[model samples]
Target: MLRVVRIAGPATLVGVGFAALLVALAIGGGAAPQLLEDPGAVVRFGLPTSTMLVNLAASGMIGALGLVLFAIPPASAAYGRALDVAAGSAAVFTVAAAFTGFFSYLSVTARALSFDDTFSQGLGQFLTQIALGQAWLQTTLIGAVVTVLCFAVRNQTALFFVGLLAVASLIPMAQQGHAAGTTGHDAAITALGLHLIFAAAWLGGLAVIALISRQIETPKLVDIVTRYSSVALICFIVVAASGYVSAELRIGSLDRLLTPYGLLVLVKVGALIALGVFGALHRRFVIKKLGDTGRRRHFWWLIVAELAFMGIASGFAAALARTATPVPETVPATQTAAEILTGSPLPPELTTANFLTQWNFDLIWILVCGFGIVFYLMGVLRLRRRGDRWPWYRTVLWIAGLLMLFYVTNGGLNVYEKYLFSMHMFGHMTLSMAVPLLLVPAGPVTLALRAIRKRDDGTRGMREWILLAVHSRAATVIANPIVAGVLFATSLVAFYYTPLFRWATEDHIGHEWMIVHFLIVGYLFVQALIGIDPVPYKLPYPFRLLLLLATMAFHAFFGLALMSGTGLLLADWFGATGRDWGVSAIEDQQAGGGIAWSIGEIPTFILALVVAIQWSRSDKKETKRRDRNADRTGEAELGEYNAMLEKLAARDGR
Candidate 1:
């Protein structure tokens, strides 16, 4: 079985992916019409084929880098081999992306090939000047950079950035796919982006491990395989989830499941389920007994089968990228300026009644908040099952935080935020301030540490990672009260006064990034103040109080700056919203400042009160400790002090 797998694994991967692509394309009509006037069969079929290679190569590069940085030790021979794999894969990615770009240009423009100066100039202009061409150009450049970095960089810790760059290189491809100029574009981008990341991790990991399996010592091989398996498991879950999302965006409804594109999706789904089962078998039987030669033999065969299935899934995905969806993504016409800017029609003017009803759901945040509530409940249940006590209020606070987060991101606030600066700021405050205030006290980290059983295996489990993160030097620095306080206050100015505000408002990626930044900054600040999660260290009560006061003062100053301002911050977006129902955008800006000042202070006060209570409790605890010491010794120290005083007096008399 081992010999068979060793020989057949890579071949099976390519073959299965190729077969799956061919099948899916035949079903979905991926072939463009072979017109007499158009570029010939080479160009026609070569485009999709190039795209499929690009995906495969990209997955290999990203997966290898991730495995190196996360699973394999830097000192191991396998680590260097993994880098070699990444370098090779990245080279392929770079080449394939460039070809895919050229093919894509040909597919779109339907021009004949030429190597003349005019052709060169036209190609340069297309790549350098156009958005669609630029996306591929950027991807190619990023791939090239990652390829070089993989070869040049050997430090394991620094390779994380390389992995990030590799993953990020896929974003442009996602953007260039069939999602643009559609209502589901955001969903498509998100789902596609996630799919690419997880899929790369899954596919690339197997390839790297298979390539380097012999070089790894038997002892380390087991550990590496176990870690990679963990990564694969997570990848499976995320891939499945993201696949569902992407399918929904493209397939639209279950009624269309019988359509060619939907059938392709079903095929991909089946492949994923098979991969999941393989992962489970590996985890249950093989990973636990890697030292057993017989078990290891079976594992290699299982890995080969898993690779084949992964290839099928990847092939289907590549074909699906080429396949046309049944529903038209294009809107008939958007007449309004807001529609032109935002891609959606201008919502009905904001009304009190609509605050409860209006919604522009962010699929990502909904999943996030939903998972948050689910996991927290799961932790609580785990604790209860083990006869452990967790504070009910902490659970309540966590639920409230997640619910509020969901509402802020997906409800009335999100609906109006694009057109209303005030609402955007309100959402920002809730995200960065109010939500953290609720969430920090929930002691999520503490709960996790207490609830998650420790893993003694060489693999770093979730609990280990959490502990490492908290105790890490980076955490220690960021968790510094001064640093957290400064960042919390300075970010508002930095964000609003720079291009960041514009980007956050204008782009979906930027918007999501903005939410994440706000939430993190808020959590850091609140954690510095009154977080129940154990940290590297804490400041004294007086310093904490001082820090809170200083933060509030800065907050007030920021509000005043906004309130006294005559110019609108985002005049272009909010100013031109064309709403007559609400107060003027400038007035709304001032009102946002007022809310930032007043409503913001309420949370500050709560923080201050909590800090004061903690201070009092600390003093009481100290007093009780001293009293207990006195009771234990019965004032022996006091008698010694009197005797010392008497001896001093006698010496003075003499």
Candidate 2:
């Protein structure tokens, strides 16, 4: 029965997915013949089909690697089989991406097929010169690289890097499709990107289990399934959240639910909800029953049922991409200066009320902050249940840090940062200084090292990976007090003086990278000074104080330079926002500099004070240790010292 399922399960998924895509295309007119300049029915139908294949292939590659890295033991036969599955999937992905790219060119150019140089030349230009073409081309090349690496690399650590590359291949695809040129283009891209990655991980994992089921015993299978269930739970949450954001952007209103495109979204949503319900059942009941010989067959059949729903969701998703949105995603007939520059209209005036109330939620940060808080609480709960004490204040501090980060990334600061330099600087200050001050002392890494169960199955789980990263050679260098301090202080000058500041302001990906860069550097520097987490080296308290003071001075210098400068940074962006209200552009820039100098120093003061307290406590502890030693030794060291003094005095008398 298991063998039959191993073969029939994936077949059912592909069949169901293909069927759903056809039905959705028919209903939404996604594959309909164009009124003019049609790329032929072949290109129209073939493009969606091939694109769906690309998605399925991508799922298999990522899912298998995820299981190998976290779930399956390296010595097990199933692990190698899973890698084989990933390799095979990558090959399929490569071919499918190539076809998708070619079909895309045909659709766009509406050019007839030919055997001449003109045809070859146009196709080459499309692949090399055009944005859509370049995206697909990059996908194909990445797929090819991943394919080779999966076959050649067997080390668990190496495969982790390969998995990252596989995931990155999806970025270009996420940026295009329904996300490009949308009103909330950045949000849409972030939403769609999260949706694709998590959905692939969820669906692809189950498929991998089916493919490698024969290599595992029931006992081991139960463990793997349990681990997979945890991952799927996370994937489900992210997928649902991102899907909501994507659907909201495309549909715009509840009334649009009756439209064809909206109905297709509803279909996909239903399928996802059903999959989620099935996963819950597995976690609650079926997983436990799988260890029973009599119930094992029944459990595998349920797996097949879950895969069918996944297929339905996947199919409808691909079709929806090709379908037109109910709300037009195009630019307006007339544009405001704010719209022209930031791709959105100028927000309401920046009153205290508006600043506190207005929000532009970044989907990525929302997930990051949400998961961070939940997982930290869970770790604390685990420690308490085990009769191990974790500080309540640490929990509070961690939660506070995440909340501040959430506000900086998703609140009013995010909304106006593109238009106003002061807002951007305010956010940068909070991200680099305030957030780290709260987060570093929380000792999240210490908690995780204590709370998470140690896995000895030759497979690296989250705890193991965290440990490896902490002790890695690269980590040793960068986490050094001096290096971290230098990076923390110099980044301010380097970023603003270079092209990075402009890139961060103008590009969505760049902006996200900028936030991450600042946050990481700040955390490292603070950790070097007063962090509770384990590190390779720590300076004495006095040097730590000196380092903090030095960094503080450098930060002030940078801020002063900006304040005194006649020229504005990214004048094109800040100066061009065309705001008639609030401060002028140069004044706003100066205010930002003032923020950097003054508001950013608040965290430095807190850090220095904390260091002093720790230093005083260390001295008291050392003194207590000496007192205890004196009592243990009964003044023998004092007697030896007196005898030496007596011998010296007798020699002087002679």
Candidate 3:
């Protein structure tokens, strides 16, 4: 029994807990109130919502358990294998749980009875409800199976399968609340989902590493921890950003951040910061001092403590997910259609002339900023003589280009309005096209190095600081492929699916987040595609090409989905007004999605072709150099010529 407990403990505990919750909900007849018009019935049951809360809590607990189990070090080789099996089984169970809960919610809500009458429904209806909930439960189960299978396998090929399964599972889960109409609801849900996945990866990976540290020698432990630090930093950023977006959307007002949900979120954020601090300690002190006597146990304790807090935070997250969204009183029922189009409401006179006048001031400033950066960069380039090294000037030019790109993409117009397809198009181009192309060539790390080199190198203090910043673990992490890809992909997923898009159009705060997202995503995608700086782990050219192709295909599919969508997924925010742009709402939306699909391909294809050409050229040059070296005279008359050739080869490599 003790052995079984250790082998199947996490899965058994989570499964039994989830099953008990479901049984309790069914026995108490709590399913009916969710379908009611009044919210009071759910409150009466001490649940902020109906059985949805119970289901969500169960799912959260299962997810948390999976995370914990994944973190724990297997006691032995057999235990490790059993843990893998248990994880797979638990994932399968989760899928069933999701499906059943979904069906239950659907069946309970489909009944015509009010909130009071629904809870009073007979047992047969409840059981029928359980059948419908199978969809998501199955999906979750499949995802778990895939994750466990990934661990069981040792090949890179398995990663692709795991990635595919993960993406498949998230699709239905993300779409579940699509009908909620509230922009905040969509944003919060999407952000929360992303946060959960990222958290799982970070916490679970850390647990694995911690367990490994105990078993491996000090040197191997240091290497593993060092490698993982970069991943953790990226995850930290994702958690913070997503958490903030979710909190802002759910609270809907600055004042409500002090409320229960907000305070809880703050606590989670605090916990994350604490985790970061511990991570820093691991990097700065623990890992370096691993060879020291008696430090190994302390490191293990720190990791365990961090994992426990992460688990608690996950639970609080479950609670927070069920909390009532604070509705702001000052929000308008329907904003002026003109406001949606032009980004601001029309003047009191309400004439076309008045509308134009009101927006002119804002538009002029936007144009000034946009055009100013472009021309300034052009001027800087013109000033530099051909073949003269002006790395700093080039850096400034790229920075200027980025600023202008931001202005056009995010600053020029209202992103949330229905009819602002042109503005959205402009922003998308900057993010997916212009910015990536420009920044890729600029090479941020190389430029930073040049800038640091130009500083006072003679001063030991300043030089040390510069070296520290450039060679830091933080720098290395940002430059990792996995870290960069996750950040890039998550940004796109968060933007399209969440209320973040809608909220940005509704308020100033949302617009700022949009700008930040565009910049970060744009930077990551560019760095992935054509970075010149040192990346810790670089994918093979073929793999990079495949990743690029896959990303493009996904974007194109999303665009097609948007274009073909019968009902408005985002119509409320992006629809057009008659006075501006002259396009109908559906036409504008379809056009935007179509452009997103069609225009995206050009840059991708161009980049792929460029990479192929460069690779081929490099291969040819390498072959020629190898043949030349083979025929060279040994340490005689050709010494000077060989040195010259070596220098040229190095230049070519750069």
Candidate 4:
């Protein structure tokens, strides 16, 4: 059975994956009529086929590395084998992505490649200059880098960065899916990006397990299966949720499932369901008996089936990319400037009611908020079950903070942010300041530390990871009092004054980076000051208060500079939005400055007050500890001090 699994498992996976791709292409109309008439059968069918290969290879490369990082012990032979697989797979991805990019050009423009200088110049321009072509090029370059790193690098922690680079290679894939100027463009990018990443993790992890089955002994197999199962569960939920969002955006309605694109989607979904069922069965029954040869046979059979299903899912996905969505991914040729810039119709007049009513569900943020609330509640429950009391106030504060962040990201602030500078600033303040204020006092790290059971089996669990992060050299530097203060103060100015403001405003990837940056910088500053989470050190109250005031002054000066300045930041974005409902763009800029100048101070004041309260409480706790010690020993240390002083005086008198 072991020999059969070893020879057939990988072969079955590759064969099935390619076979499924061919079938989905036929179903999804890889033969469909094109807007252009010049490109022939090879370019049409070959483009998606190559793309399927890219996806396949990328999953194998990324999933193998990630599993090694997260589940397998770094010192094992399995780890080195995983890296070898990643290196081999990434090399394949590099080649495939380069071809895929060239094919994309052929498909989109219906042009044949030539070796002329004109053709060479155009190809270079497309690769380096055009968004769609640039994405594939980036993917190729990233894959090449991963290929080399997988072979060259062996350090475990450094490999985590390699894993991250592998994950980021998909960002361009997500971006090119929905071209710029499409309605729901940001949401589509977010959804598809997440879908690609988690799907790869899920698909690749299983493939790695099949690849490594022969090398793993029974005891290690049991442990590996259990750990990978947990990762698989997380991947399942994310893939399911992101798939739904992408489907809803593209499919639009259940009736549309009858269409070619929808039919391809259904094929993918069916495969996903089968995969989920197989995974559940493996976890529920098969994994418990890995040591038994009979159950091991069953497990390998399940692995084969799971790999086939993954192939189906991956193949259908590639085909779907080539298929036209029921609704075109891009808007019609005619569009308002606002639509072109912001990817949606100019928002209706900004009203108080509209702020609360408007929504742009950034899927990444929704997942963040959702996971945060769920995990927090779980921690609270864990504490409660053990007859331990966690402060209700802390939970409320945490929820409130996350909800505030949700509203700022998805609510009215987000709705108007792209159109009005004032709204953008308002949302920024909430995310960077108000939200952190509410959340910092919640002491999330403390709760996680107490609630999560420690793992002593040499497996780094979530709690251990959190602890390592808190005390890591990187965290130590970032969380330093001066560094945190400087980052908190300077990020606002640096972002606006630099190209970052333009990038964040226009690109989904940059927008997400902005959100994370603001939140972390805010959290770090608060963490340094009033944060109850364990840190290397918290400053004395006086020093903390001084730091707060100094940053406040810097923030005020920045806001004042904005208010007093005659210039507008990101003139092309804010200045060109062509809004009619709001005060002119210049006035909106001034309003943003006012919000920054005033609203930021409110959060600073709150930080100061929290610091003062914590300081007073610290004094009270110290005094109580001293009095309790005195009572315990009848003030023996104080009496000893008094006797020593008297002995000194007596010696002087003699």
Candidate 5:
């Protein structure tokens, strides 16, 4: 366990350190510019021109190294050698790009002097630098192709397919950089590049470990897997830390979170937490019984669920890379002074707070209607559980209480525009955090099963329908990670950036969508995490960690981009107030983005650590169990036949 912990520690440290550095850069990098009287002009003309060239070179090299690593084959002993080369190259290039981008940003902004001139100059310089960086990135992609060629030379089919998918994924990366027309493309590029490499390490390492475990014919296999497990754990930590930093930098404002970008971040975070829980459960329950026949199905199910979530996370990441970051509304110092003298009036829309105020009236209606129906259901359940005289009133009251709780939690309706940052945060907490915990214990599946059993004799159609609904492929797919992640993340993106966010703010229709989307996304995210339901795919632990990391990175970048953006993407909606509250629009945008990127990491890192610890403990416990069983047998060579008889007898006794 100590050795396992040691192995995982460094990788996590490296990842966390890197993430911290990135976050620092995003937040502090703009401080100088914000303090200037004419920050825009300073950024445009005051900064130097050479920094762009350096950044371009650095981005190119890092991208190239990533490509090369992806191209190498797992079957070859040379695989590690190739990866070393790629890592070395990427390190060199990333350092160069980071310095170059930093210097260029500083020079162009001139610490926020000569605002107007700097703005134009800085924009041009930044663009040029990005173009160069893209060039390097493209070259790195070519190197990846070369690595794929090497895999082909070795006739490695698995490596080839992995390479192919890696290559295909690059399309979204390339498109996203330019598609949004946002100036934060450099940061986005860096985030995406790092994310890909880290993901590969995590997932690839897990694959290696799993393969090694399966091939273990002797005690040596245990040591080999233990070593590999350590590596995988470290990789997982890196993925989580890096992802957190990136998301914090992308989200620009609290208001923009209601937009697609914010919602997606929430969904991703939820999914990650869910995945961690599943990993813990698997390590605790399944690992100890690895060789037991009765537990094989459960083990397989857990694995499948993990993998399915990983795939879903991967797809969501792809979508995230393309989504636009939100820009915060700038409240200038001059405007702040004016607002002090003349206070602003609240908007006429019925906000979330308003809905809370009408709670009593809503509750009365819910109690009357909800209790009436619940009473009927209780009478039915009681009839089945006990013949006729079973405390039916008590059961009815219990049902009514449950409905009251549900109504109180979800009955509130709020207009989108009226939602303040605090309220929005509260809503997200309820959906992503509170709701998941409640639903998990509710055991919807178990409840449905019980209900069906009770109703089956008299209500054959209802039983068959319930069974079919649960058994259907469509239901299976909906419960799958891919569908869940996509639905959750996509809802966030679609609702926020498009007219949907504003519409939801304007009418009751939008509120309904928000509620539905949250519930669905929440359900999916939790299900993916706990893995109580059947999942069609199974990802190894390392792979799940990698996917989680990648998803977070995408989110961070999204937030950072929003924080750093010069113009408001949602200007028409947010700009109407003309209230620049002492900060530049871009600065506020960056701050909000940073918030999203940074906050999500705490839970993510904790989850990763828990997974590693759990896995290590399980491995040790299983080894000890096997040893004890061997000792108990006392030199008697037990064949499969004898083992089966002993297992049956033990079960009968239990």
Candidate 6:
């Protein structure tokens, strides 16, 4: 029965996906022949089909690798087989990507196919120069690299990085989607990216399980399925959220639901709902019965059904990419200065009320904040249930910090940061200082270590990974007070003075990277000072105080320099925002400097107070230790000291 599932699952997935894609394309006019620049029926139809294959193959590669990294033991036969699956899938991804690229070029140019220098040159230029062509080229190349790495690398840690590379291969595809230049472009891109990544993880993981079920014992298979189910649950939530955002952007209104694009979206939504139900059944019913051989066949058959639904979702998703959106994704005819510079219209004037009330949510940070809070609470609850005492203050602080992070990322700061230098600085300061201040004291690492179970079955679990990271040499180096302080202090200059500032401002990916970089830097620095989590090395209280003071001084100096500067940072971006209201670009930059110097220093001062309190507590504890020792030892050390003093005095008298 398992063998039959192994064969039929993938066949069912491909067959169903192809069928759905054809039906969707037919209904949506996605594959219709162009009247003016028809690339022929072959290119018109083949592009979506090949792109669909690319999605399928990429999913298979990423899903298998994820299972291997997080669930399967490296030494197991299933691990190697999963890698083989990834490699094979990657190979297919490479070929399919290349074909999609070719079809895309033919469709765009509508040029006749010929074996001539001109045609070859045009193809070369397209792949190298054009953004769309470059995206496909990058995808194909990355797929090829992933394929080779899967075959060659066996170490679990190395494979994790390879998995990251595989996931990154989807970013270009996300960029090429319908929302690239539209309103809410960043939100759309983020949603689509998350959708692709999590959807692949969900669909491909089950396929891997089905293929490898017969190779493993029933007990182990049950464990693997349980783990995969957890991942699939996360995928389901993210896919649903991202799908809604994508649909909202593309359809624009509920009334448009009858359009071909929206109808395809509905089909995908139905498929997602069906897949979610299958996941629920597996967790609630089928997994427990897997121990009984009599019920094993039912599990495999259910997997077949789930794969069929996943196929429908995948196919509609691909077709929807090519389908025309109900709302046109075009810029306004009369672009404002804000729209010209930031690709968005000027928001209302920056007022105190608007500052607090406005919002522009980022899906990525929204998920991060949600997951961070939930997992931390889960860990805390687990500790409590085990009769361990976890601090309520820590939980409060953790939740508060994540909420602040969410606000900084998704609220008013995000809305105006693109148009105003001051707003960007304000958000940056909050991210690097205030949020980390709250989070570092929460001791998330310690909570995770205590809550997650230790695995000794030659498989690395969350506990093992956490311990490995904390004890690693890199952690030791970075956790050093001097190093963390230097990174925290000097990064401001390095980032703002270099092209990094411009990149982080203009590009969504770069913007996200900026947030992560500063947040981590601040976390490491604060953790080095007052964090409850264990570090490889720590300075004495006095030195910690000294380090904090020095770092903040340097930080203040950076702000002063910015204030005194006659020039503006990213002059083109901040200066060119054709706004008739608010401060001039240079004045705004100076105000940003003032914010960095003043508001940013508030958290540092809090750190100083905490360190001082810790110092006083340390002295009190030392005194108590000595008093106890004297009590236990009958004051023998004191008597000895007195006798030595008397002997020295007698010798001086003689």
Give a tens-digit lDDT track for model 2, residues 511-586.
9999999999999999999998999999999999999999999999888987887798888889998798998999
Error of 4 at 379 (Å): 2.5
Report the C-alpha displacement of residue 212, candidate 4, in angstroms. 0.6
Model 4 misplaced regions, further than 4 Å: 32-35, 113-118, 291-294, 643-654
Stretches off by above 4 angstroms in model 2 are: 292-295, 635-654
lDDT by residue (89-182, candidate 3, tens digit) is: 3454455444445334544454333457545464335444443344455555665665566456433233334544554454344434321335
Candidate scoring better on TM-score of 3 and 6: 6
Residues 1-654, model 4: lDDT tens digits: 667886677678788878888888888886566765657788888888899888889889988987777677666778788888899999999999999999888777777778889877878888888889999999999999999999999887788789999999999898888434578888888888898998888888888878876677777778888888988888888899988888888888999999998999888889888988988987898988775553577788888888888888888888888877887766687888888788888888998788778887787888888889989999999999999999999999999999888888888887888989899888888888999999998999999999988866555677877888888999889988889999999998789988898889888788889999999999999899988898887788999999999998988888888788788788888888778777878888988889999999898888889899999999999999989999999998899999999999999999
Arranged by TM-score, best first: 2, 6, 4, 1, 3, 5
The lDDT per prediction is 0.85, 0.92, 0.53, 0.86, 0.45, 0.91
Those runs of model 5 whose alpha carbons end farther than 4 Å from true positions after fitting are 1-426, 451-454, 457-466, 533-540, 577-592, 602-654
Q: Report the Cα RMSD per candidate.
A: 3.2, 1.6, 14.1, 2.2, 24.2, 1.7
Best by lDDT: 2
Q: Give the C-alpha miss distance for residue 444 in model 5, angstroms.
A: 2.8
Model 6: per-residue Cα lDDT at residue 64: 96
TM-score of each: 0.90, 0.97, 0.51, 0.95, 0.34, 0.97
How would the candidate models be sorted by lDDT, starting from the highest?
2, 6, 4, 1, 3, 5
- Candidate 5's residue-wise lDDT over 208-230, tens digit each? 33222233332333333233344
lDDT value, candidate 2, whole model: 0.92
Give the higher-lDDT candidate: 2 or 6. Answer: 2
Q: Tell me how far the alpha carbon of residue 106 in candidate 1 is from the true structure, in angstroms, after superposition.
A: 2.4
